[model samples]
Target chain A: MRSHARIGFVLLLTPLVLWLGLLIVIPHIDMLLISLRERISFGVYETSTAQYQKALTEPLYLRTFWRTAVMSVLATGITLLIAFPVAYYIAKMAKGRLQQVLFMFCLIPFYVSELVRTFGWMILLRETGIVSNLLQWTGLADQPVEMLYNDAAMMVGLVYTSMLFMVVPLVTTLESLDDSVIEAGYDLGGGGFSVLREIIIPHAMPGIVSGCIVVFMLSLGNYLTPTMLGGKDSLWFTEMIYNQFIVRSNWELGAAFGFMLLVLSSVIVWGMLRLTGRTLQETMG
Target chain B: MIPTIPQSRSFRLVYGGYVLLFFLYLALPLTVVAVFAFNDSQFPSLPWQGFTWNWFFGDSDPQIGVFHERGILRAVGTSAIVAGCVAMLSVAVGMTNAFLFNRYEFRGKGALYVLMLLPLVIPGIVLGISILIASSTLANGVWDVAQLDIQALRPGLLLVVLGQFSFITTIATLVITARLQKFDRTLEDAALNLGATRLTAVRTITIPFLMPAMIGAVVVAFLMSFENFNTTLMLVGSDAPLTIAMFDRLKEGSTPLLNAVSLLLMLGSSLLALLVILFQRR
Candidate 1:
């Protein structure tokens, strides 16, 4: 009976194992193998880091790689800055029904696909877009200014896309702090900034780190937003990877670019977690 | 200054300004998407010529509404089918995997749990690349070993479903596992002690308890599958999902017809989420 139960448990676990093991693990291993080798011919191949060397040494690839890293970090920082006050309001200030409605308000658009959401931004920011028209109408600008296809536009899209990931964690951590703690700090003659520094921020550090980590990782590896929002000159690294595979049909080169992104993200994520003293398990949710 | 003081003029001003600005930031773009669906302009952006329902319904030159747009209905149909399959399958796999977690004490379970969740953190683009490369490479070997149709092993709807299922199943499992954590398993043991078979106990007691979470998982999986773009873009064959369709239209110079499509999707997702929120409240 015990053996039969063990068999059943094994059976129960098989699908999960088969899925993660087959689709995720095996494929990534294959990709790793592909990255290590150079394509010699149509059917022949080699084992070398030539692809990695190309990715590392090529100026365009290297420049875009660093640019993606820097942009993602900047986007994450901007998202955190914008999200904190909103999260604080929702967590601390709102009443019962108001809180629920506010939370839902933030969530409803998230249900809209990122493609649609980004498209909405496109509509609003394009040369003849709403913002430009409004600017022209109000005499703020002489003619239609191309508000889309710029770094600021890219930053806007990144911040907009990553807002919820930051807000959710911040709210979760902020909600747990007692109201009286802030009140006590204020009563003890702490100014607003000091209270924020000594009481609120320290209390919310875990949430802040988790939100930043998630947002940074997301924006770093993101392809669609940068492409659509940034237009032809976006030069996002993921686009480079896409070009390597789909455009250039260089699978080995694409694989190498992909792992480099993986390493960059992983190392930063690790360092952030260490600095913040948060565990992988805690930050993930 | 106190962060919260209704009496303080500066505090009220700051609070009101912050809330209004942030809410507008969140709501304005989506509002534009919905509003421009009726814009008479040929271009989807601004300079709204006049209001027209033609974008939603008119079928004529320069105004082939979303309904009449070529390949759109088909893309929507494909998205629905794929989402439906992904939802059902991810839930089934998730529940089964949750059983593995909830009903047993085993070695390496912790490690395996982490492994299961690794997909969640890995970027969708990387995940897409890995699956596309590995599956194409292994297709012949898999076909030979299983003696299945070559098409089954190829990149198609099946591959898309599998790629989505990998991460989504992990999510479903996590949801159900959270439910199971608070579960009193003694109820199952009690049922067995009372001479109920294992299957009977699970069917009557465990399943009923899990039904809510299972439903939530199914809803989440469906929505995620529907909206998924990055991973699906890489894995997609000749056929395109709505997202891919929209991206294509962007390249082709789109019309307000795309706005109609976005509005419809937004309405559907909002309605579904409303139902879920209401269901949970009840």
Candidate 2:
């Protein structure tokens, strides 16, 4: 029986070990090695930091990385602000059936692909799109306005794409908060704003931290929204990675950028967790 | 139920308006996309000429519908195949992972668990690129050593399936493990005590109980694989999935035909999402 159990354990463990080792662990380590080397000639290579050096020195790469990071942080912040009240209402205010329905509505858009969501945004924000037509009809603008290709449009698309991620975590955490706790704050002469600041925010910190992490990562690594909505000059760092890998065939530089992005996102996520007094295991779980 | 706090009428009114506008913002873009799919216009935007099914059904020059567009149709089929493959593979691996985590006591178990969750946090683009670089390097090494070529290591549909499976399996494992954690061990123990072998007990009792979550994981995994764009973009070769194909067409600018495709995607995914939610509710 002991021998049989041991064999059964190995049988179950083999696939998982292969899946994680081959797909997750080995590839990342290989990428790190690739990034650390330079292709000296057609078939020869030398170990060097030139790829990382280029990522630092090149104005385009540096600027785009900065822009992507800043924009991602901004997008996360905006999503948190917008999703809080809605999540609160659904988690606390709405009645049982309505709560479920409202949450479902929040999830419906996300069920569709991000490409479709981006397409929907394009249809609404293009030069002759619905919003432009509405504006002209209301005499706000005599000529059609091209709203699709810009940073603001990109931000809108990012926020829209990331809203559900933020909402789900926030709702989950907020729903778990005992109602009596909040009632206690109110009964103890706490005003709405005070209670929220002192009680609700503290309680929802884990949710806020987790939601922000997911949203920030999504926004930072997002290739579709920024590219389509922000036009050719989107200057997104992920696009730079894409260009390097596909167009330039510069895998070394692309690997470097990829690592930089991984680091940048990790730092932000770690910093956010630290500030909120949470751990990766805790927040993710 | 007691209200958390007393609110003034003005506060309630303002909050109500905010909530109303919030839902509108969520609904507006999808509504426009769905509506414009039927619009009889060259472009997807503005000035609805009239209602028409030409975008979905028209055939011939300048009016080829999505159904007739061979590239779009092929991409849809490719996506379905890739999604089905990914769903099955991820579920199989995910169920095993659940067992490994739940049923065993091993060293580094906590570390392995965290490692499993690592893919979830890693950016999808990075995952795709790493796999791309790693596979090519592997292919090059094999060629150098053995003078043999391997086409499967190159970017293609197989890579796409593998790339999606990398992360989707994490989610799948998480979902299945949740259901498994709730399972009563005593039932399996009872079966064992009743002269049943371990395999038979699991096959008849444990597997049946986990069937719902396993099905839910399938639908969830399928939706994720079908909608995956970032990783698929990196690894896709000759065959483009629907998202990648749509992206290319959008880059060249699109007509209402694309909106027709979007509408169909919306309906299909909504139905799948509903199924997943129903299973979860059970």
Candidate 3:
């Protein structure tokens, strides 16, 4: 190879490789060591799996583990149900400028920070919030109904936060589908339900799976939303990890819990890929 | 859509209402955030006392508008600094990877690409802790080997920037390389055949085509860095970004001033989205 080209290659490649190595690889390996060992004193330690054992055996941790898993799955399902019609309308039914405008309507709000979005929910859901105030003003109720600080509120927040991710992918796949196929099905004496079930659903399958994976992963790892919306009672697994690191300052346990969360997300993602048969490359976009 | 077929009445009513409500759900929360920023009441929610610009321009004894709040302004400045640096660094690094790995033949190139993306797939909370673990260990290793204090090496804004850059660079790479895949190699070959150097050909032909994606990537990286909370919360020291600053204020029993900040941020983000929409199409 010519010297200039070789030099150009090294200069180009070194930063990325060094960055991934130093930050991504080295840290996680260090995290493994931290999780495996108990700190004896400042800057001293012995290797043990006690943190993982405690995480597995403790009721709070275990309950939180299941709760996070179930909640994330439920949130993913809810987001899918809400996102599908929106994606369909934008991708299949809506025409020209209207399509882009409506889609942007969905996309713009998400451009706001998740913190801002969650706070918006709090403002609307708190006992003295607009919903309660409106309810009382119209004599629908005598008292302000506290809507925030509950599981259902948490779900609403999660669904709102994650709806955009699902919509984009579904639109991508749905747009690729031929309109004539659906028209043909309708001409063959098929009802709307049969046409949709037989044609549209199958065609949008990859998009659906991809959307679910992204939504699931996001909801599972989310900390700020549940903590803010669900109050202190929120049992999100990420919160458990946050408590370990921030509140308790237990690095060992935090590392262990972080590792556990990683494992859970990875396993679920792998299982989803197997079921959906999507390559990692296709889904990454 | 083909726009040839018409829908049934029931179909139109149900799906139309559903879509309208869905948009309402998407938009209502943010509208509330914006509306409350101008609310005269101390608290953001209920019975509108009257409209006031206090949250934006006016200042009272205790709570000043976000524009007048020094602390919030400082955090925004800090956030801008961090995000600007992250955008440049991630784009530079992402461009490098896209050209070298995607365009050239190299052993372990596939594996390296996957490794770069591992950060993207993993929960950012986990990535943040891992950075904390790795950096502290590196500090200790420095202490042991060189007998140096290296207090500057501790977790701070630099660490936070690096931690965010680690994955955001991956996102940048994905965007640029997706553009790179559609590159026409014949142009380079033609340029080389005409006695132009490989570097010059790349600089002229390839890089110009990549301008759109690179700009998009920089925009995305900047936004990601700006709004980032999960990973950043772990690596930060005493210095707080806007998200952390706002969260701290909320946790301390916030007032309408918080809504003002939200309105400003939402406006900034909406403007960015508008830029992307105008420039790039799905």
CA deviation > 4 Å runs, candidate 1: B1-7, B140-149
Query: In candidate 3, what are the lDDT values of residues B78-107, reduced to their tens digit?
Result: 899999999999999999988887766778
Clashing pairs in 3: none
Candidate 1 chain A weakest ten by summed lDDT = A276-285
Sort candidate 3 into its docking category. medium
Indicate the fraction of true inter-chain contacts that candidate 3 also forms.
0.76
User: Which lDDT tens digits does candidate 2 get at residues A1-285?
Assistant: 889989988998999999999999999999999999999888888999999999899898898899899999999999999999999988888978999899989999888899888888998999988999999999999999999889999999999999999999999999998999989888888887888999888888889988999999999989999889996666899999999999999999999999999999888887987887777778775
Predicted candidate 3 versus true structure: per-residue lDDT over A200-223, tens digit per residue: 989998999888988998999898
What does candidate 1's lDDT look like per residue over B100-152, in tens digits? 98778889987887787777778888888899888877875676688666775
CA lDDT, every prediction? 0.86, 0.91, 0.88
Fnat of every candidate, listed in order: 0.67, 0.74, 0.76
Query: For residues A1-285, what per-residue lDDT tens digits would candidate 1 score against the true structure?
Result: 999898998899888888888988999999999999987888788999899888889898899999999999999999999999999989988869998889878887789999888888888888888899898999999988897888899999999988998999899999999888988898898877898899999999999998998899889878888988896666898898888888888999999998988888889988998998877767763
| TM-score (chain B) of candidate 2 | 0.97
Candidate 3 to truth, TM? 0.96
Steric overlap count per candidate: 0, 0, 0
Task: Give the DockQ (2 decimals) of all models.
Answer: 0.67, 0.72, 0.71
